[model samples]
Target chain A: MKFTINRSKFIKYLTDVQRAISSRTTIPVLTGVKITIDKDGLMLSGSDSDISIEIYIPVADESNQLEVIEEGGIVLPAKIFNEIVRKMSDETITIEVGENLQTSITSAKAAFNINSIDVESYPNFPVIDSNEVITLPTTLFKQVIQHTVIATSTQESRPILTGVNITIENGQLKAVATDSHRLSQRIIPIEVPESLKENSYKIIIPGKSLIELSKIVENQDTIEMMVTQNQVLFRAENLYFYSRLLEGYYPDTNRLIPANDSTKLTINANDLLQATDRASLLSHEGKNNVIKLTLTDDHVELSGNSPEIGTVEEALNYIEATGDPLVISFNPDYLKDALRTFGHQNVVIGFTAPIRPFTVVPADDNSDIAQSFIQLITPVRTY
Target chain B: MKFTINRSKFIKYLTDVQRAISSRTTIPVLTGVKITIDKDGLMLSGSDSDISIEIYIPVADESNQLEVIEEGGIVLPAKIFNEIVRKMSDETITIEVGENLQTSITSAKAAFNINSIDVESYPNFPVIDSNEVITLPTTLFKQVIQHTVIATSTQESRPILTGVNITIENGQLKAVATDSHRLSQRIIPIEVPESLKENSYKIIIPGKSLIELSKIVENQDTIEMMVTQNQVLFRAENLYFYSRLLEGYYPDTNRLIPANDSTKLTINANDLLQATDRASLLSHEGKNNVIKLTLTDDHVELSGNSPEIGTVEEALNYIEATGDPLVISFNPDYLKDALRTFGHQNVVIGFTAPIRPFTVVPADDNSDIAQSFIQLITPVRTY
Candidate 1:
């Protein structure tokens, strides 16, 4: 391939695609990025078996400053290619493929000839049909991903728990994730084409894939999501992201949350987060890393103690508290993560008992706390 | 131990002393920081045997906003104490030591009760007489440390090579360090007090200790240095930095540098640095990571090749070239490190042969290359 491209534009897209290339892949050719130049444009792709990212630069897009002198394809080592592109000083770089599958890259006064693998050695991008598509604004999709992905299990022993289940039920799009100890659910209303309303999607997408997709979808106003029985594709302008679906059935978590509350407290999210963060400092060296919270008529107190290190006590004046007075202990790290997901100024916390999980949601004057975004944390036994 | 001090002031001094506290030290008490409050001021100290840092905050120092209410001392766990001090929100924090070594730290709405060790359990700070001291501007001392510390050996097999050798001959002060592969030397002239004019000293200071001392001596006009038989003390204002000297005989590296040159090339330091940096990319993935340079009458070409990866060639226009045209191979990392040490815009490179070590010096029209500063790199036998 003999092509000249804008250095900055190429570098930006290459960086985005490089995130999908894993260094420890068993397939050696998967470590390299495939570059193809033809009459349409230049396509760069990278995959690590689980996820694949492809970016296209159209020939007619003058903003990218791309020129096609010849048409060919090659796969270059991703690590070295990324290093060279990031350090190139010239505005434009020219690349040409020659004998022995060697590619020459020249810019300003620097020229590099890198050995490349045959393009045929790369795995083919799986065919994904764009017939049934769900379209949403990039901003809304990003918000949903951030709200629930944090609760997914990092341990791969339970593969289903490592994914965030995205489902469409009765025209409502919701994403839920739980790692047994905590759960996060986000619900949003989206518009779907009338022809595809009969079909619903309940696919479990790995949390790691959604994190990478959110970063790659920047600069686009809207995203088109295409789902199949085994794969999911998200298209953002000239970029396409594909991820394999987790095969196991996700555990039903609806019955896990309690229906009634014994006590409820309304407090500022930032104040509670800071108090718990400080209290956790003393408890972190302990085995359980548990912090206790007690509510009284006038104030709420958070405390942590360790035998080796001493104790810490932080008190805050809650907005209001009703129902029975309560005392409970839980992992402060889980509570911290739950508090960070709330965008509202005040959060309503509900407790059934010290042994059962508690619920946290954005405080609303008129609506029920269960309808919108909710996070649940299972308290640890401190005794 | 029992005092209310400005939170920000305490945090700054605590951070400086915390660097000397190592988690892997065999002595358990060394993991804690000793805080002593007396009629004069408050002292914070931490040590890991190799280096000890002590910072004193006087009661009357308005800049530090310190106030001592009682006279006592105790040692608190360094890791937990540092974390708590960093997160304190109140303008002033009150710390009181109660019965059974229970220390209470209170600020605004946060309170922490931490266990502490008796002050007697902490090791005593070695007293070094200041009668024979060398005083120099902090800026100049920092420059000398930076110029030679990078060449010290990181491997501890030869403990002597891990320290920078400092020598004083007449009124000239010189520092040199080498890892056997490359050597860096810096020399400067300074005025000595008449009482110490007759004595010449040679000492080796651990490179790690000098690094920490450089950071602690910031914003000071002058620093007092006392070199004893086996230790060095650097006192900057209220901060005293003490480090044990490495005990061994330093090798004589003077004979390793060649006196004559077969080829001499004058080139822009930045241009040469950037070219070699790019050429090293392909070679970095190879076994030796060596880059070759060819000096012709017109230009200097830098090239690197890997049998599996391809090749890179970078050429730069030199200001001038004299002596025989030559080709040489060396580790690009060593050349990069040597070039980075030269603060001058242009440098003169001298090569005795393809297999011998080469010298790089600041470009001078009339002075000899060996006069001010010099760096030597041993070339690899590419043939």
Candidate 2:
């Protein structure tokens, strides 16, 4: 294989494909990025068993300035090849396969001759033969992923909880994730096919895959999603991302959210977030890493204490406080993560008891989209 | 003790002092910052035995807006205190010593009550009682430190090599550092005291201390340096930095520099630096981490090979390559560091033999200052 392209433009595509490659893969060939040059364009593929990414640079795009001297394929070591390309001292670079499977990469007066693996040894990406496709707005889908992925369990003890449960029905897409102690849910609207609109679909995608997909699809306006029995593909204009689906069933979290509250507090999310951060500083030095929030008819206060570090107390500024007085203790890091998703909007926190879970939702949310999002956290038993 | 000062300005002094405080110190009191408040202003001090820093915020400085309420002293935990002050929610923060050695730090509505240690337990900074002072230009001295510190040995095997030898005679101040394999030396003119003109001074300051002093002295125009029997004090307008002297005889490095060469290569420092960086990428993956430079009457080329990986070759662009044909191999990282000190200037590299140490100096160095700076690197024997 032989080809030359604009160095900077090629680096952009290479970085996207590299996100799917892992050096710790058991399959040695999986650590290599497969490169193919055809009459249409150049394609780079990388995978680590669970997730695969392929980006294409079309020859029709004049900016790429792609010149294909010969059409073929080869797999090079991803880590070193990327460093070589990044440090090359010219605006353009050329790569050619020589005798004995040796590849020469040249730019300016510098040349690097590296060993290459046979492209035929690389594993093939999973094929999705289903015609059913679901179109999603790039921005909205990214928001859904960011909001719920935080609640996904990072521990592998319960592998199913490490994935977000996504369900589509009646043109509304709902995503939920819970790690037993905390839960987050977001609903967004998407265009469902006529035949699939009548049939409901549910899939559990690993949180890591969703994060990588969100980053690569940032520039695209919309993404086309196709699902097979064991795999799902998210397609953009020039990129194809595939992820394996988790086989086990996701736990039901609807019953975990409280329907009523005995005490409520309304405050700006950013205001409470800063106060929690300050209190957390002390708690983090302590053994339990927990902070307490006390609500009364006349005042709202947050406090944290570490036996070795002393105590911190802050009289928080809140919009309103009603119902019964309550004191709740929880891991401050959880609340900090949940509050960040609400931005600067005012959020209403509902609490039923000090030992039970509490819910935080947008205070002035009246629209269907805003009302459909909620974050719940289970408080620690300080008593 | 009680005082209120501009939070941002106070933080600046706190950060400087905290640099001298280390949590890993054997003395627990050394982990705390000593704060002494008087009618004049507030003084913050921290020490890690090897290095000590004291910064005074005077009431006369309106920018500080420092208001002293009482005269007393206490030592607060450095790490947590700095964090609390940084995260406080007001433009000005008030710190007051309450009953029972508990200090209350208040800003806006947030309050943090932390335990404090008796100021008497903190060690006192060393007194450098020397009438002789050497005045050096801030920018020039900083440049001297940056150029020589890179050659200082990071390994503790040769403790004396970890410090830079600084000597002052007549009106010239010279600094030199070496790690056995490489050496860097720089000399600049400084104003000597009238009484000390006939007396010469030599001291070895730890490389780590010089790096920290350079960072904190960026805003000052000139710095006054005083040397005592066992300590050196770097005094600015409001800051005092004291470092312990390394007690050892520095080896004479002047005899190691070659007075003549059989081969020379002249090239832009940045151009060679970039090419060296590219070649080093492959050598770093190999066992020896060395790159080769071949110089002939017609061309100069650089190459690196890794038995398990591959090889890289580049024909260097040079202004001149003359004398006997030669091939030398050395660590690219050492050359890269030396080249960075020259910036974009054209440098003349002098070589004698394949395994002998070579020197790099400014090509067009006509000024005394430029001619006084030189970097030497010993080549490795590949055979």
Candidate 3:
């Protein structure tokens, strides 16, 4: 397409769309970014099959300085075109399509002529037929994603575990993810229409897609979400992010969390995180990568040992330790990840037994919605 | 052995010594850092056979807060020890050698018991028999190293070309390095001892070693260099850096520089560097990885082409383009690397022929040292 725009402002939109483009995509045309310019504005689209992103630069925004010389469209190689734009030695760049599907990109005295694929060859974006839009506070939604996504399985052995199960019912939206060994759940209040209150909506979205969506929607106040049978769309002011939904049913994880505890330890999340990190250093050099935590009536201690590297022990500082004395061993990396989500807040860790899964929840979380924002980790059997 | 010191201050010394320690070394003991606590102070040493570093933390330096309880020595695993010290949860850390060659490292309530090797098993550092020390200004010497090291051959086909040939005589030190295709030479004035004026000393120091030395010697005003038959020692206030010399004869590169020129182009070094970076982007994607420069009486242009990708052309902004009209092709990466050394200064490029090597020299250079700094690049014979 024949168009010129501010180089820096255009780069910002290009980077957002590029998140959906992967160099390793099997579809060759998917590796290219589709650029369409009309009398109104310019739209850039990128997709890697599972996720697609589209950003529009409207002509009404004077800062963009967008001028459409001709109404046309073309798809250029994303990787090289991005490099060319970044390295161009000018404040503004002009891109024009020429004969034989050759495109000329010029900025200052530098000009590059690269091959282009016809825009018609690009696959059409999935049509999100549902007109019902669910508007959610960006900050609360981001927090829910950040809290639960960590427990999502990165391995593809169980593909359904790779996605976070999100359910909206009555006035609350709940997000849960579990990789069998660890689980995280967070619930937040939302405005649910009366028509959909009876029919709860449940969708499993890939955790990877949510991360990209979170990053690109940073400055926006709210995001509008629309769902179809097989696809979901998150729309901001001028940005649209679409992700494919996993087809299989998510496993029921409610029974996995313990209802009662025999022992409890209250400590600052960051303090415990640091001790676990130090203890794990030696364990990481060993075969099992596990650390032990011993809680007594009067003291609490963490220790790790490696036959080749030696041993590390730390008398942890805790606010309180109560109930029956207990000793537990687990992969410290799981606890570290869960603790990070709590930041500087004090967390109460509940243990049912030495072998059963333990739960960590904010100590000061006295909310109306009980058991919200809880992380559970299955302890390793050291004995 | 036992000593307690400020954690941050001790970590600084440990990091410097760890630079010389590589986990991939054949000698297992070399992977450990040798720590010797004497009545005077603590000495930390690490070596990878090719390079050795020893940093002394004296008791007189109050910032170290080093208190030696006993006089003994041991070698602790470098990587794990450094990590433990960094993650220790206290302002000060105490390291003590307990019974059975087991060392106890304690900070706050955290304790680590790690296995240690006998100090006698660690190889001793080489002794430099020469008493004569050559002092060089740190800033100027660092500049000389930076200007020439980029041209040093990374390939081991010609082992001698991997080291910079440094010669000192008549109150001047000259350093030169080449990868055969490109060469960089830099000379700086130094105060030569009266006794050493009669004889010129030539030594080939590995470029890799010089890069490390430069990074560690930043705050020092001057560095004392002592050369022996097969080793070179660079000593600062509390640091001693030793590097093995390359045992080979360096090829004479003076004859390769052209004495006369038929075409010349003068431009700001930074301006040309940016243009070269842009041009190289396309060439890097191609097979030959070469870009062409055309210099005429009025204009200078740079262009690069990739058969599968496309082509890029930029009319370079120059202060002067005079002499015979010419077109030359060469690897833009080499030119970019050489141009970066000149920074913001204007440079005059001299060319004798399209196939012959061309030289780039600072345009404002009128020093009596004649060619104090110069970069030469051999052009590719592109038809």
Candidate 4:
């Protein structure tokens, strides 16, 4: 196969596909990116064990263009191929495959002959059979991943907790993730498919796969999600992302959330975030990284202490506060993460004493006031 | 003792003094910054075994706004104090020393009760003595250090090579540094004392100290430098900096350089740097990090290869070529460093042969039109 492609176009697709290629994969061939040139365009594919990304570069006529004389395929080492394409000065790079899988890439003043592995050596990706499919706006999908993915457990000891729990019920798609210490839940309304009307299937998707899909769907208009028995395929315009679903039952988290709270606070988002951030500096060195929040008349005082490093106190202005004054201790890092997801000006935090889990919600971020989302953080006993 | 200083001024001074404060110092007192409050102002000092830094945050007003009710001093842990001062929300933090030597620093909504050690426990700084002193713009001092310090050896096997050789001869101050493989020499005229006109003293100043001073001095204002028996003091406005000098005579590097060469090539500096940087991408993984340069028929080819990772070749543009057609190999990293220091659009490289040493100088950035400042690099024999 011999073809000349625009350097920038090839570079963009190469980088997009490289997101899934892991250098430390147990499957050695996963480290190589598969490149195929045909009459339509050039397709590049890369995958780790968990996720796969494929990007297509169609021949365009505006500027630097590509021409294909033959149809063939080869797998090149992603790490070295990326560095060469990024550093070459030529506007266009010509790639040709010869005998013994010898791949020659030539630019303006530079030429490289790289030995490539046989494309057949790569593991054949499972063909996704689809009975259920749903379409969602790319922006909304990316937002769902961003809001809940940070809450997933990084430790794989309880393999089930490493994935985000996605559930669709009563015309709403809710994404929930928890590391046993804190939980984030994001709810969005979508046209429910008639096939999923029986019961909500607890689909647990690996956090890493969602992160890669978020990057690829960032500025796209729409994305088509095809759900098979064991795999999920997210197809955007010319790029296809596939991730294997985790095989386990997600825990029922609905019982952990409290139905109501005794005292509540509406506070400016930035002020609360700044106060918690300052208090975190003193608590980060401690064993649990816990910071205490004390609420009174119209303000909340955030305080934290390290036996050797001293203590810090910050007064946060609140929109309103009621009921008995309450004090609770929890991981300030969880609150910091929740604060970053807020695009609105104010947030309302609800508490039921120190023992029960508390929730933080956007004050006016909800279209329907009765349907407000909440982030529940478990309190740590600071004795 | 008590005083309130401007937030920006205190933060700036704290950042400068923090360079010498290491977290793992053996001496517990050395890990702390000493604060002395007297009628003059507040002095903050930090030190490790290798270097010491002292910065004074004087009262900012037309005169002195520092009201000293009593004179007192204390040493507080530098790392914790700096973090507290940096994270405080108040524009000006009020600091006061208690009867028990405990320090209380209060900002808008925050207060810290930091424990402190007695100031008498802190090590005494060396007395300032000037045998010879000269003054130059801060920019010139930084330029001098940058030009000569990069070639200093990092390996401590030969301790003297780890320092930059500084000598003053006939109203001129010159700096030179090398690790036997590459050498950098820079000279500029400076006024010397009448008593120091006998001969040049080739004293090796530790390269690490020069790098520290370069970071502190940031402008074109004149800074007075005084050289004592074992210390160098740089005074810039109200700031006084002191650094310890190395105790060794530097080697004479004059005879190692060739007087002139029959073959020379003037090429664009940017083009040469890019070629070397690209070649380094592969050579860096190889032993000795070597790249070969072949000049033939007015064209230069920069090439490198790793047996397992393939090879790369590129034709480099030459502005002028009178060099003998030959191939030579050397550490690409040393050439990269020399290129950074010798900042010119085009540079003329004079070569004796493939196995012999060579010199590189700016095409237009000559210290003198007739006598160009030359950097010499010894060639490596590659079979």
Off by over 4 Å in 2: A369-371, B369-371
The TM-scores that each candidate's chain B achieves against the reference are 0.96, 0.98, 0.99, 0.94
Error of 4 at B50 (Å): 2.4
Order of quality (TM-score): 3, 2, 1, 4
Show model 4 residue runs off by greater than 4 Å: A61-64, A193-201, A297-299, A369-372, B60-71, B193-201, B369-372
Per-residue C-alpha lDDT of model 4 across residues A114-208, encoded as one tens digit per residue = 77888878777768777666777789879889988888999989888889999776767788899898888888877756876664545889998
Candidate 4 residue-wise lDDT at B320: 83
Q: Tens digits of per-residue lDDT for model 3 on B55-145?
A: 9999998999999998899999999999999999899999999999999999999999999999999998999878689999998899999
**Residue A237 of model 1, lDDT score:** 89
For candidate 2, the TM-score is 0.99
Off by over 4 Å in 1: A365-370, B364-370
Considering summed lDDT, which 10 consecutive residues are worst modelled in model 2 chain A?
A: A364-373
Per-candidate DockQ values are 0.81, 0.87, 0.92, 0.59
Candidate 3 local lDDT, A272-306, one digit each (tens): 99999999999999999999999988999999999
Q: What proportion of the real contacts between chains A and B does each prediction keep? A: 0.84, 0.80, 0.89, 0.55
Question: What does candidate 4's lDDT look like per residue over B1-383, in tens digits?
Answer: 77776666688888888888888989999989888877767788888866777776565542433455567788988887887888777777788888667688877877777677988999998778765667766787688899888889999998999998887777677788899999988777776667767756556788988898789766857888777777777777666677778887678888878887868888887778877887887787566689999888767889987766667788887788884688899988888888877655688888988888888887787364233255789888988
Model 2: pairs clashing at backbone N, Cα or C within 3 Å: none
TM-score, second chain, candidate 3: 0.99
* Per-prediction TM-score to the true structure, in the order listed: 0.97, 0.99, 0.99, 0.94
